[model samples]
Target: MNRRDVLAAGLLLPAILGADTGQERSTFRIGLTPVFLDDQVEFLKRWRQYLERRLEAPVQFVQRASYREVTELVLHGELDVAWLCGYPYALNADRLRLLAVPLVEGRPLYRSYILVWDEDLTSRSLTDLEGRIFAFSDPLSNSGHLFPQYVLSMLDLRPEEFFRRTFFTWSHRHVVEAVAVGLAQAGAVDGFVWEMLNRLHPEITRRTRVIERSPEFAFPPLVTSIHLAPDRYALLARVFLGMHADAQGRDLLTELGLSGFAKGDRSDYDEILFMAEELQRA
Candidate 1:
């Protein structure tokens, strides 16, 4: 109901949904980070169908409201593969292997956007929004929470000390809705999600304006437990890298607003790793 309640419920969600408990699974499990799931349920269904056919294996979708739950599943081996933001991937870099990275506008980079009500021209910057109720998408999200917190740290301020109150909406769309409908005075959300929403739901997006944008960083990537077999990993990588060339896969990518997938390595996320370190120090 409130920020504390929302956080408590989010922490308990995996258990509430009877999430997998580090058990070995036979099916090819693909866990979504839950950013796009709430917005594109039908598109996800179609994408899953394409993956199932290409992988030639039974695929199951594992999801949770917050990235934390799904990250835990991937770390514990409950999920064979997962789509996670750069922040979480860097947080558990030792335990996860890069699978593929989405190419947005033919580049494996995206930004974090600070959003405020469109008519509120008075608050054009982060400092201007001090003491305002702010919404973050998720604690483990790069665009939603980490980058904004980093911004505050740079200002020599902590979130609790800067904002009147801050809350996690658990999803980027919720962050958009909260600011759009005036539940929150300002919010931080993924730039990609914000743009997609602007295109798909202008009625709601019309109410918000981007007050600031963080520098570009590596996009969220598909990942797997480090223990996944090398051969299986190769197969999965091949499928993703070739998706843009395959007719069915290309169509799915179009529906998903993706250019294609590119092979990603640890070096691609060095900036995110640095941000993680900075946040820890803050």
Candidate 2:
């Protein structure tokens, strides 16, 4: 069968099994971008458990070492749901639909942070970091790559010409550790990830300083393929949006460093789309 046919069949499996079976017949698949995986293995485990128990269905976690890989899986309907970076979601708006966005610092907004070593007082701003080695989380990441690139463009500087060298660490925690361990003179990271690291890995964060913070932008969001049945997507949405209200669910969110999940509209990501356009224009 083609992708659309497969997706239709997957969504109907539960009903096709009929109610007499007394067992859930469908597996709910969730894709995760690599950005949050390295430091969040335990959290992911707990999250999977919470989802499975809450939905009373088998839950599987699909992940890759690249954001683009996971994003493509969701876009092509290989995954029923995915937690994706705003950049990819905005780029694939037609193929993907937002489910919910995690609330950080009590808001559905986060920023890109430029970080340097704690003792690196020589760099007070983005301009001061010229000719220094830098790390980015992922090429398709909003906070880790796009936003930082946008900032440089705003300064009329291209990343290649502004930095001595740069690399992608694939995970935000790795970006924090790169700067903290002096592997990179500076790095761009997800502010939410930085905050989580500050609490979980103080040894790494204590040595890092925020050199710059991009203005508030849309948070990364959970999304699903537009091909999925509306009821299937709506069921997933109800679980997330109501997670903070249940005891077990609340614990899971706390472990994930999220306040809760809120229904997110596509328009919530317009700023990111605008930034992407600006980056291409410059």
Candidate 3:
């Protein structure tokens, strides 16, 4: 199946398998975006089973198209928890509790990448693509949207005036696709996502080259609604934090190209908050 088919199947899987069977169990809902999980149908199934087994409750994975949608759901109590970009989490920190952050290369940090077609070796910076089409993953994306915007603000170049045209693919993977297929001359994407795709789908990534890298920022995190029951919240946190210690969890982390999950603090996203504030005042 293609990416769209896989995503559609993933969206419906929760409802089909999470049906009530007259058991006195409450479903624990977790929201996800297609940013990294666009084609991870099997992984989602396995991860859900793993969480359900550990949490000793029904677990449901709710997939959405963008970070803003998932963030809204979590903030409104439609989701118990969500693995979200640091941008949205920082924006709504008061309404959400930091549950965990994924560890990449043993640290809960990642960067943003500015990319162009691989053969375009002449371009060295964002300024080089000043008059070309650009793809942004999502408006609420720190790496894909905010970072690029911040860079432009520093240069005193507004996106509308700098780029010939700009668009949102809504998925980091698609941003890579846009650049690869010439839909976009350049794009801003999550460095971690780009690396993961390089490992899992090199054919696509090989067509693109990383022209620039931003300073490291805290990796995206799993967050819970502040109103979640304390006991349930603790269980969710324990399962994620202990993933590295368990054999199965360790295997899952390996597949995801992550070291494990860490008990991250709200302060971990201070840099992102600063960027957001600076952009707001610009």
Candidate 4:
């Protein structure tokens, strides 16, 4: 199908493709959140079909509106695997096994971008926007929420006290939208999402400009519950790690703005964990 046709099909296919029919006991379920996937319905359908073909098992992509919901489902073993933010993964590490991390520009690292409207040339840093409205993607998001919060904490200021008002846009794209349209004076968003949107939807990104970029942190990762069978987990990991080697898989990765997947090290998230720990103490 052409891109337009695929996008249309994606909007209409969720009920038919993503719902649990209660018939496939062997289905390998993977969870997602708008933090990454956003509205790429066609991409999800294509990736699901690719995974089903590779694993020789039925594959299902379960999507939730927020990272907290996806993380809770994965922790309760309701989902076989999930693409999760580094903060949530660190918060529940003992119950999850790192499955794979996506490579962005060939590195498994990304940053948090603090943004302002393109016309707002005077605001160069977060302090410049103090007492102005702010947008946060999700409470559990590392780059969107934690990193921004950590910045405030380091300055000995609290979000409620620093900003006149703050709100959650629930997704990184919306955070950008909130800032671009003047709904918020500033927003914290995932750098990967911002870059991807700049590539695919520049009209929206052109209205906003990134003012600050945080230190590199491990990118969001795909994780499986520790309760999963060893063989099943290995199979899932192998399929992901081998994506770049296969033509069709490589195409899917490109469409998804990824370089492929790596059997990522758990230690990669230590910085996120340390930030979380420090926040708890504060």
The candidate maximizing lDDT is 3
Candidate 2, which segments miss by more than 4 Å at Cα? 1-25, 36-39
TM-score result, candidate 2:
0.89
List, residue by residue over 84-109, the lDDT tens digit for candidate 1. Answer: 98999998999999999999879999
Writing each residue's lDDT as its tens digit, candidate 4 over 86-177 gives 99999889989999999987999999999999999999998788889999999999998999999899989999999999999999999998
Q: Which lDDT values do the candidates have, in the order given? A: 0.87, 0.88, 0.93, 0.91
lDDT per residue for candidate 2 within 71-140, as digits (tens), equals 9898888899999999999999998989999997579999899999999987888789989999999999
Could you give candidate 3's per-residue lDDT for residues 1-282 as a string of tens digits?
999999999788867998554333468899999876789999989999999999889889999998989999999989989999999999999999999999997999999999999889899988899889999999999999999999999888899999999999999999999999989999999999999999989999999999999999999999999999899899999999999999999999999889999989999899999989998898
Ten consecutive residues with minimal summed lDDT in candidate 2?
17-26
Estimate the lDDT of model 4: 0.91
How do all the candidates rank in terms of lDDT, highest first? 3, 4, 2, 1
How many backbone clashes are present in model 1? 0
- Give the Cα-based TM-score of candidate 1 against the true structure: 0.89
Of the pair 2 and 4, which is ahead by lDDT?
A: 4
Instruction: Point out the worst 10-residue segment of candidate 1 by lDDT.
Output: 19-28
Off by over 4 Å in 3: 1-25
* lDDT measured at residue 254 in model 1 versus the true structure, 0 to 100: 73
Which RMSD values do the candidates have, in order? 11.0, 5.9, 9.4, 9.9
